[model samples]
Target: MHVPDGFINAPVSAVAGVVAAGAVAVSLRGARKELGGASRSAASGGERTAPLAGLVAAFIFAVQMLNFPVGAGTSGHLLGGALAAILVGPYTGVLCISVVLLMQGILFADGGLTALGVNITVMGVVTTVVAYVLFRGLTGILPRTRRSATVSAFIAALVSVPAAACAFTLIYAVGGTTDIPIGKVLTAMVGVHVLIGIGEAVITALTVGAVIAVRPDLVHGARSLAVPLKLRIDGELVDAPVAAPAPVAARSTRTVWSVGLVTAFVLAGFVSFYASASPDGLEKVAADKGIDAKAEEHAAADSPLADYGVRDVTDTRLSGGLAGVIGVGATVAVGSGVFWVVRRRRQDEPADARVTETV
Candidate 1:
């Protein structure tokens, strides 16, 4: 949940800011390796794959708008960090979550502008790293079976949401303005989020499992486990297709792009109307424990896009729907453009001198 300004003290928020910045810095470097890795599947497209990455980000943003109920009056939205990291690469996933949080804070005024750093740290960095690590560990330790991947996805996502909640609690313990008991805060935050985590696990597992079924090659987390393209010589392993990887045809890219964009539009524009209107886990806890007493109103609350509605749309549903659609479009366009540029820039780099010389 987008922790608003008054929820966490300035010191805690600042620390989160630093943590978030550091994580982004690390991801920038890691992204190079993740994106540059070799692939065996015919779908292991390179630079042209950037548009798909963008679609993942946009889809995450759109689905996040549909907040599912946890229990009681509290609800939880799709953090999407784990889902993205599994679907796309971890670095790109971090970038994707950051973009969504930025839009939410600045455009929708949903999350506090001042607390943007904290949200990014707790929701983006913590979730992505935790999920990715768990996914990898499980994939390695368990049998290399399809069921293992789905099971791993479930556990990784289940753990990540509460881990984020615990992180927030720790931050609050350090910089909490009020004298609330740390134990109570921790217990409450973790307890509520555990339920939320179930929802997270189901959603992440379903979404990731779906992609892995269709295009496991497209899934960054699942890339290393890709089925090797071996020669069928008497049912024995042979030299895999290791040289000059096949290029991604333009027609395939167009198909993926179109389908993804359409899915994002439908989810955000129409499905969001039915999202739970109840308070989220954090909001419910804040009210129950008096943590919200010092909460400050967001400065951008007056913006036209604030609260997910256009400025002058007469119908509430129409306004919110349009805003959601526009948000999806904008997020997709920006994310895709940024990723395309990054992929292209990397493409332009000379192939590794050592590898080239060897070849």
Candidate 2:
């Protein structure tokens, strides 16, 4: 849920900001190892995390626009934390979501700029930490088949959405701007988001399964937990040793990247038009319970791409489509740039660190 301005008091908002900033700082350093292939862990065998992480960010931004209805006139979008953390590492996943939230706030004016820290903390950190931890736990306990990993993704995503709802409820209990009863808010938020979590779970499961089917090596959550690939010899099945990671430059993810980028553009540009128009879980809870009584207008309300439409375009389809396309392009560009830098930092680290990770 994207917490808008005025929902939280300035002091709490500032505190959340500092907390979110610290999280981002920590994630930045952690992501270097993930993105740099220091771990040599890709489900697709030799794929690198940097490119996939960028696509994951862009894909999350695109899929988020396609809000599926969760009944009771409430709609929900993909938070992408579970999906990202499963596809990439938790640290890099945090960065991916932060990038999406940042773009949405500054460009499309979806999330409030002032409440950005709240959004990042609840949506990014809380969701990622909760989902990844659960996914790891479940995968560890279950059979080490690819199906088990996919099942873990489903369960992890299912729990993460409501966990985030609970987190927001706690935050609201502390700093809510309205006079609504905290108990009612908590019940309503969790109830609606539980339904929303189903939607999130389905999406997360399908996406994780698809990636694992083709590029299991590319999936971070599936890494090491995966069963060895079996090749049938003349008369029997034989386990094949894992292939060494290809040199970074020699590994080409162009096919996957191209397909993912195209899918993102198509979803954001055209498919988004069919998304349910009803308010999402948080918006519905806030409106029905009077929590948004003091909400402020988005500061970027006047931007050219505000509200996912072009400023001067008269045709609704064309305007929204163009805005969506621009958003995808911008998100991919910025995400790739950020990951590139993170990966570079890993390469620049003292040679011993690489040896340590490799060992």
Candidate 3:
């Protein structure tokens, strides 16, 4: 959900700005560990997965362009908040979605710049925390099957939307510009988001399930609970016994980069045309509750790429499609670059005794 400028009051927005800044700071540090550690961990038979993380972010960005009809006049897209956090890690996932929000706000004018902090907080932080908590809790008590990962993905995303809605309501209650009834805002916001949450759940579960099927080792949320990979010996499957450890395989990173960039281009260029053209969760709530009365027009409204249309491209479909493609390409490039740096930094660490001695 992209919160416009007028929904939350000044003081609350300022506070949220600080909170969002802090969250981003923490995420930057945490992302270094997650991306780098995962890269190092992949030194074994485990597959290289950092580029998959970037691809996951790019995929989330593309899918979010399509908003499915929820109810009444409102529509919602895949939140991807929970899905990203689960697939990658929480910190990296937050960075992924924050990048998407930044692009949408500045380039497409989909969200407000003044309200960027709020959008990041409610959507990124709230969803990640809530989903991660629930996922961990459920995975702890339930079986460690891929089904658990899928089920957790569904439920975690389901709850995250409304939790964000409630958080916005609370913020509005504290800093609402209008005198709208708190009860009305709360009811409307929560109700609409509940529907939006369904869309989020389906999308998150499907994406998570798909990734788990292909590369369960890459999913950060499901990492701890994964059953150890085994080899079939004498027609019976058993965990591969640890012996004198073999040298870590050095796979080419080129394939990961190529595949990620290609997929991002395809989704944004070709697939986004079919996305539903309805207002998202935040836009719908603002209209329904009079929260948008004082909304400020976006400063970048006249940008060449405003509204997801390419500059000087007269064809509506082509312009929008090209813009989407460009946006995806930019996001993937930037995201992969950041993650690659993090991964490389990890690789640069003082060689550990285990690796140094072996080498």
Candidate 4:
């Protein structure tokens, strides 16, 4: 959920800002390892995989716009933490959601600028940590099959939503500016979010399953589960011809990136029009429980693209679609740029330093 301004007082918000900053720093360092896995070296087992992480971020931004109905007068959308961590690494997943949140706050004014820390800590750190840990644990215990990874994604995503809700409730219990009882807020938040988690789980499972079917190599969580390329002849097994050459493998990464980017554009630009119009879980909860009593207007509320619509565009559909498309483009660009820097820094590090640093 996107916490708005004034929901938390200055002191707690500042603390959250420090926590968010620390998380971003840690994630940046960790993302370097995962992005480096995409190095051009054939021995690395991947090529330009960093770009795929950008696509994941853009895809998450696109899907977050499609709010599905979770209950009477309430809707929910993809938080993307579980999906991202499954597709990329958990650190990169954190960065992906951070990029999306930053975009929404500054450009769309959907989340308040002042509450960026709260939003990131709740939606980015908590969700990614919880989902990734659970996913890894489940994948470890379950059969080493593709289905297991997808199943893990579903369960991880389902749990992450309410976990984030619990996190937010705890944050509010300490920093809330309203008179509402903490028990009521926690119960309502967790109750509605449980339904929302189902939607999150379905989207995560389907998306992870589709990617695993097409290109399991691109899925970070499924890397260990990839079946060996083997062929049996004369009762002996050898490497199969299924493995592509290095050049072809590099080209495949580009192809996948191109296809994913196009899909994100389509989802954000066109399919988003069909999203539920009802208020999302957070908004509904805030309104019903007086959490918004002291909520201040967003700093960027006057932006031309505020509220997910273009300022001068006449048609509502056209305006919103354009905004969504713009958001996807910006997210891809920024996310790619961030990943590129992380990858380059990783590559440039002295071998001794790299070796000396603990992962």
Residue pairs in clash, model 1: none
Query: What's model 2's lDDT at 195?
Result: 94
- Selected candidate, larger TM-score, 2 vs 4: 4
The window of 10 residues in a row where model 4 has the poorest summed lDDT is 37-46
Candidate 2 residue pairs that clash: 42-217, 42-218, 43-216, 43-217, 43-218, 44-217, 44-218
User: In order, what lDDT does every prediction score?
Assistant: 0.81, 0.90, 0.79, 0.89
Off by over 4 Å in 1: 37-45, 227-248, 350-359
lDDT tens readout by residue for model 4, 1-359: 78999899888999999999999999999888777742323433334558888899999999999999987899999999999988888999999999999999999998878789999999999999999999999999998899999999999999999999999999999999998999999999999999999999999999999988988878888888755678899999998766564354567778888999999999999999999999998889999999999999999999999989999999999999999999999999999999888888888888777657643
The number of clashing residue pairs in model 2 is: 7
Off by over 4 Å in 4: 37-46, 227-248
Cα lDDT tens digits for candidate 3, 1-359: 78877767777888999999999888877776677653356442223556766676678888888879987888988777898888888888888888788878887887788889998998889998888888888888889899988998899999999999998898888887788899998999899999999999998998788767765665788777656679999999999775654443345345544665676677778778887788887787788778888888887889999988988999988998899888887777777777787667666666683355336
Per-candidate Cα RMSD to the true structure, in Å, reads 3.5, 3.2, 4.3, 2.8
Q: List the residue pairs that clash in candidate 3.
A: none
- Per-candidate TM vs. native? 0.89, 0.92, 0.87, 0.93
lDDT per residue for candidate 1 within 1-359, as digits (tens), equals 78898887887788788888888777765554454533312333444346677888889889889899987889988888898888777887898888888888888888887788889988998899899899999999887766788889899999999999998888788877677898998899999999999999998998888877866666677767745667868887896767765555678658767887898999999999999999998888888888888899998999898889999898988998999998998888788776766665555556674245326
lDDT of 2 by residue, 99-189 (tens): 9999999999998898999999999999999999999999999999899999999999999999999999998989888888999999999
When 1 and 3 are scored with lDDT, the better candidate is: 1
TM-score of candidate 2 against the unseen true structure: 0.92
